[model samples]
Target chain A: MTEAIQKTVQPIGVATAALETKRLSAWFGDLHVVKDISLTVEKNDVFSLIGPSGCGKSTFIRCLNRLHEETDGARVRGEVLIPGAGKRENIYAQGVDPVSIRRRVGMVFQKPNPFPGLSIFDNVAAGLKLAGVVRRNVLEEIVEISLVQAALWDEVKDKLKKPGTSLSGGQQQRLCIARALAVRPQVLLMDEPTSALDPISTARIEELVMKLRSDVTVLIVTHNMQQAARISNQTAFFLMGELVEVGPTKSIFTKPKDSRTEQYITGRFG
Target chain B: MIELSSRDGVRKFSNYFWLAMLCLLAFTAIAPLFFIFAYLLVRGWAGLSFAFFTEIPKPVGEVGGGMANAITGSLVLMGLSTVFGVPLGLACGMALSELKKSAIAKMLRISIDLLTSVPSIVIGLFAYALVVVPMRGYSAWAGGFALSIVMVPIVARSTEEILKLVPASIHEAGLALGLPRWKVLIRLILPGVRAGVTTGILLALARVSGETAPLLFTAFSNSFGYRGLSAPTASLPVQIYTYATSHDETWRQLAWTGALVLVFVVFCLNLVTRILTRRTV
Candidate 1:
C-alpha cells in the first residue's frame, strides 16, 4: 500500500489535484462569508482547513460541493472545477446540476446526523438506493465494504438493523464517513467532524482520516490545530472570510509566510 | 444550616399556595370534559345497540331503528376528503416551509390562515356552488369536497408548523447525500416528522367526522347509505342534527347514541395516531 501510494504521490502537472477553485466567493444575503479564494486539492491527500470562529472555513468547503448555495439568499461568484465524466469541468458553469456535483463530492457535517428512523445498514446504503441501485446483494456488499473501510464494521456488524443514532457519538461520525464513502466519491469534505466528540473519538477519527488517503481525497475543516497537523498533508489557514495562507502542513505551521497565519497557529490571537 | 426566618416561612407558604392554585386551575379546565363524557355515556348508553351500527334510520313513528347508513356515509366522506385534502395540504405546507420568504408563499400562508377561520357553513355554500350546483345535484362527492375544504387549511397550517420544527441540519444531511429537494423532503424530512404529520392528519379527520353544515347542503341526507360517490349520502352529524331537533322521543334518544358513536370514533383515531407515532427505540 505504501509503495503504491508513493508511486502516485508525485505531483504530475495539474492532473494530481482532484479539485481546483478560482476566485470563489460566497454570501448569505449581504453578509459576505467566503471571500475570493483559489486553491488546489491533490488526489489521495488529506487536506485540512483550520481557522477561528467565523473565518468562513466551513463555508469555503461547502461551496466546493455546491452546498453553500442551499443557504437562503446565498450566492456564489467564482469557479469550481472537478474532473467530470471525461475531462475536468467547471462546476459553477451554467446548466450544471448541483445534484450531480454532490453525488461525486460527498460531505460530512460537523454534527453526526445519521438519517433518523433508518437502520445502520440502510443509512450506509442510502446514497446508492436513492440514486436507483436496487439489487439487495449489491447493496449488502457495498454496505459491508463501507462499514469495514470506516473501521466500524467490527462494532456495528451485529446490529446493522439498529437505528444509526443508537451508536455512540464517535461511532455515528464514522458511520457517516462510511455513508459518504459508499458512493465512492472522488473527494470527501468534512466540516469540524470531531469538534463535538470526546478526545478518544477525535483520535479515532483522525486516524481513520489518515488511513483514508489510499481511497478518497479528504478535505477536512477543523478547529483543533493539533488535529490539522496530525491528519492533513496540506493545510489552509482561513481568517475573516479570506484564505490567509495555504501550504504544506510542516512549512505552514513551522514558518508561515503570513503574520496572521503565524499568530493564529502560535495561539497568540485568532 | 440556614436559620428559618419569617421570610423563609412566607416563601414556603407561597410555594404551597401557588401549587394549590395551579392544581385547582388545571382541574377546573379538565373537569368539565370528563363530566360531559360521563354525561354522554350515561345518556347515550341505553340507545346504543347492534342495530345502531347495521341499520338505516327509520321514520318518526318507527319503534326501533339505527343509523348504520349515516355511519357508513361519515366513513366514505372521510375517505374521500382525505384523498383530496392530505396530498394538497402536504405539498402546500412543504412549499411554504421551503420558500418561506417568497411573495407567493407569503400570499399562500395568509390565504390558508384566513381559510382556517372561515365559517364551515360558508365553506358548505362554497361546496354547494362549486360541486353540487355544477353537478345539478347534491352528492357524497360534494360533501367530501366540502369537508376537504374544511380540512385543507387545518392540515396545511399544522403540517407547515410541524415541518419547521425539524432542525435544518436534518434536511441539509439529505441534500448533502445528493438527493433532490423533493426526495430529501420525502425520504428524510417527511419520515423524520411522520409523527407530527400523522397527528395533523388525524386532527383533520376528527374534525371531518362531526362536520354537519357542509354535509347538510352537499350530501343532502339520504334515507339509506350512498350507493355511489355521485349519490347523496347520510352522515352521522346530519343524522344527529335531524334526530336531536325532532319532537319525537325515540329520535331524540337516538341522537344521543349517534353523538356517543362520533366521540368514540374520534377517540379511536387519536389512539391509533398515538400508537403509530410511538417511538420505535
Candidate 2:
C-alpha cells in the first residue's frame, strides 16, 4: 500500500472542478469500505474512478446519491459541496434533501436495466413525467431528442412503442443512458456501465460517454484502466478502500505519482 | 472389474429417479381435475333447459320452474363484489411492495393474511351479524360484502408476490430518474406485475362465483329475482342446495343446470386470463 503514495498526478486548473468531497468516509456494518477519501469532479468534464473489485469504488459512487443511505451506522464526516445553479450549496448538510440532490445528480447501474415494463418512449420520458411533465406533445419531443442525444434514435425510432427490453445489449445500455438524460440531470454517475456488455457494445457506450462530457459532468467507476485513459479527463485510483492517487488521465497512466497506483497499473497487485 | 459404484453413475441414477418422481406427481395432481370436470358434465348436462335458466325452483313434489333468478343473482352479487374488492386488493398489494418500511403497510399485510385464513363460514357469520343484523334483514349487499372480504386477501397476496417478482433493477432505474415512490409504483411496478395481479383477481372471482356458505346467511335465498343490491338475491350454489334436496326431479335437473353454468363461467374466466397472459408474455 505504501507504493501507492508516489503515483504522479498531473497539475490541472482548479477552475474545472464542479463538485468536491472534503473528507468522505463511508462504512457498511463494521466494515469500513471507503476510508477518508476525497476527490473533485469538474463541471462538464469526465472523471473516472478506476480500482479493483471490493475496493470501495462502487460504495463511494452509491454514497454520492445517498442510495445506500448511511442510516445504519453509516456516517460521512466530510463535506461534499456542489456549486448551486446560481449560488454555492452544501450538498452534505443534514437538512439537505437527498431527493433534490438525486435529481441534479443521476446514476446508471452496471446492467442495462431499461424498465422492462415500459415502452422505449416511456423509458426516456419516465424522469420527465416524474418531475411532472404531463403534456403529450412536449413529452413526445423530449423522448425524441433524448433518444437522439443518446445516439439511439435511428435504431429505435420505428419501435418507440416496443418494450425497452426488446433491444440488443448495447442499445439497451444506450436506452438507459437516454432514460437518465431525459430528466436533464446536471451530473451523471455510472457504476461499471459497460462491464456487462460485449466488446462492440462497450465501444459504442465509450463513444457515447465522450460525447456526453460536453453537456453533463460524468463521474464513472470502472475496472477498465484503458477505458479511463481513453475517455476521462481526470482519473482517481483506489486500493483497499482508500484513494491511492488522482491526477490527469495521461499523467496517471504514464507516470503515476503513487507507487501503489503504479503497481496496480502494471498488474502487480490488484 | 465393473464400476457400478462410481460417483457419476450414482449421481445419474438419482437425478433420473427424482425427475421421474416429479413427473408422476405432476400427472397425479392434474388427473383429478379432469375426472371432476367429466363427472360434473355427465350429471349436470341433462338438467340444461331454457326454463332451467329462466324460471325459479318449484316446491317439494311439483316440477315446473328453474334457476334463472339464481343465475342472475350470482352475476349481480359477483359484479358488486368485484367492484368493491379489486381496487382495494391492488392498492394494498402496491402499498406492501412499494412502501416496505411503513407501519400501515405491515399491518395491512398481516390483516390480509389473517382475513384469508379466516374460515368462509366465519366470514358469512361475521357479515350476517354486522350487515344483515344491522339492516334487520338479509340482502344481496351483505353477500357481496362477504365475497369482497374473501376476494381482497387473495388479490392483495397475489399482487404483493407478483410485485416482489419484478426485478429491483427496474425500480432502481425509475428511481434514478428522480421519480417519486408512488409514480414508480403506479407507472412502472404495477404495469410490470399487471398480468400476475389479473390472474390472481380472476382466481378470486372464480372462488366467489361458486361460494355458498358465506352468502347463505347474508344473501339468504330468494326464489324470485332481486331488483338490486338492497334486495334478497339468488345465487347458483345456494339455489343448487335448495333444489338438489327437493323431491321434484325437475327442480333437481334445474339445479344441475345451474351447477353447469357456474362451472362454465369459472372455466371461461380462467381461459381468458391464461390467453391474456400468454399474449403479453
Candidate 3:
C-alpha cells in the first residue's frame, strides 16, 4: 500500500520548483502589506511560513492563489509561475484567468469553513462539480478518495448525508482539506488551518500535512514556530511584511542565519 | 461599608425598575397584535364558509357572499410580484455586497434606502403612470409592478445584510477552488445565505400581501375573477378596503374574513421563514 501510494505521488520528471514568485508585493488600497519578496517552492515539498500577527504571512500565501486581491481595493503586483498541464505559466500575466489559476492552487482557511448548506459528501464534491464532472459514480469515488486522503473518511463515511458543519471543529477542518483536495490542485495553500482546533485535532492535521507532501506541494502559514519546525522541510520567516530568512527547517531553528530569526525561534520576542 | 452597600442596593433597584419597564414596553408593543387578531376572528369567523372561499361576491342586499375573486387575484398579484422582484433584488444585493467600496455601490445603497422609505401609495402612482397609463387602464400588471417595486428595496437591503454576514474567508475559499466569480457566488455564497435570502423574500411577500394603498390605484377593484395580467384585478387587501368602508353589513363581514385570511397567509410565511433560518443556523 505504501509503495502504491508512493508510485502514485512521485513526480514524472526531475524535481523542480512547483511554484515560484518574483518580487511579489500586495497592497490594500494605500496600505502596503506584502513587501517585494521572491520565493521558490520545490515539487512535493512541505514549505511552511512563520511570522507574528500582522506580519503579512497570510497575505503572502493568499497571493499564491490570487485570493489576496479579492479584497476590495486590494491589489497584487508580482509574477507567480505555476507548472501548467505541459508548460509553466505566469499566473499574473495578462489574459491569465484568476479562475483557472485558482483551480490549480487550492486553499484552506484559518477556520473550518465547511459549506453549511451541503452534506459532507456534497461538500467534498463541490469542486468536482465546479470542474463540470456530472457522473454520480465519479463524484462519489473522488469524494471518498479525497476524504480518505484527508484522514476523515473513517469518521464521516457512515454519515455522508449529514450537514458538513455538523462535524467537530477538527473534522470540519479535515473536511475542508478534503474539499480542497477534491479538485486535485497542484499546490495546496493553508493559512493557520489548525489554530482553532484542539491539540489532538491539531496533531491530526499536522500528520495529514506530512502525508500530503507526497501528492501536492504544501505551503502553509503558521503562527506556531514549533509546527513549522515539526512538519516543513523548507521554512520561510517573515517579519513586518518582509521575508527575514529562508532555509532548511532544521538550520533555521538550530543554526542562526539572522539575529531576528534566532530571536523569534528562542521565545525572547516575537 | 454602609455607603457601598446602600449604593449597591440603589443600583439593584434601578436594574429591576428598568427590567420591569422594558417588559411593560414589550407587552405594549405585542398587545395590539393579539387584540387585532382576536377582533378579526370574532368579526370574520361567522362569515367564513365553503361558499365564502369558492364563490363570487353577491349583489347588493344579498346576505350570502364570498371573496373567491379577491383571493385568487391576490395570489396572482403576489406571484407576479415575486417573479419580477426576486431576481432583480437578489442581483442588486449581490452587486452591492461584492462591490461595497465602489462609488456606484455606495450610491445604489443610498438609493435603495430611499426607495425603502418611499410610501407604497407613491409607488402605486408611479406604476399608474408607467404601466396603467400605457395600457389605458388600471391593470393587474400595474398592481404587481407597484408591489414588486415595494418588494425590491426590502429584498435588496435584507439580502445585502445577510450576504455581508458571510465571512470574507468563505468567498476566498470558493475563489481559491478556481471557480469563476459568478459560479462562486451562485454555488457557494448564495447557498451559504440561502435561508436569510429566503426569509427576506418571504418577509417582503408578506409585507406586500397586506398593502392596500398600492393596489388601490393600480389594480383598482373587480367584482369578478381575474381577466389576465392587463386587466384590473381584485386583491384581498383592496377588496377588504372596498368592502369595509361600504354601508352593507354582509360586505363588511366579507372584508373582515379577507383580512383574517391575509393575516393567516402572512403568518404561515413568517413561520416557514423562521423554521428555515433555524435549520440553516
**For every candidate, what share of the true interface contacts is present?**
0.57, 0.53, 0.71
Q: Which segments of model 2 are wrong by more than 4 Å?
A: A1-16, A70-77, B1-32, B54-65, B99-110, B272-281
Clashes of each: 0, 10, 1
Q: Give one digit per residue, the lDDT tens place, for model 2 in B223-261.
A: 778777888898999988987887677777777777778
Instruction: Give the TM-score ranking, best first.
Output: 1, 3, 2
User: How does residue A249 of candidate 2 score in lDDT?
Assistant: 92
Q: Which parts of model 3 are misplaced by more than 4 Å?
A: A1-15, B1-26
Question: DockQ numbers for every candidate?
Answer: 0.62, 0.51, 0.59
- Sort the predicted structures by DockQ, highest score first: 1, 3, 2
Q: What is the TM-score of each candidate against the true structure?
A: 0.92, 0.89, 0.92
* Model 1 lDDT per residue over A1-270, tens place: 999897557446367779988899999899999999988888888999999999999999999989989987899999998888778899999999999889889999999989887899989998899899999999999999999999999999999999898999999999999999998899999999999999999999999999999999999999999999998999999999999999999999999999899999999986
Tell me model 2's lDDT, rounded to 2 decimals.
0.84
Candidate with top TM-score is 1
Model 3: share of real contacts kept: 0.71
Q: In model 3, what is the error at residue B198, expressed in angstroms?
A: 1.4
The candidate that wins on DockQ is 1
For each candidate in the order shown, give its overall lDDT on alpha carbons.
0.90, 0.84, 0.91
Model 3: per-residue Cα lDDT over B8-88, one tens digit each? 999999999999999999999999999999999999999889998898999889889799999999999999999999999
lDDT for B30 in candidate 1 is: 97
By DockQ, the better pick of 1 and 2 is 1
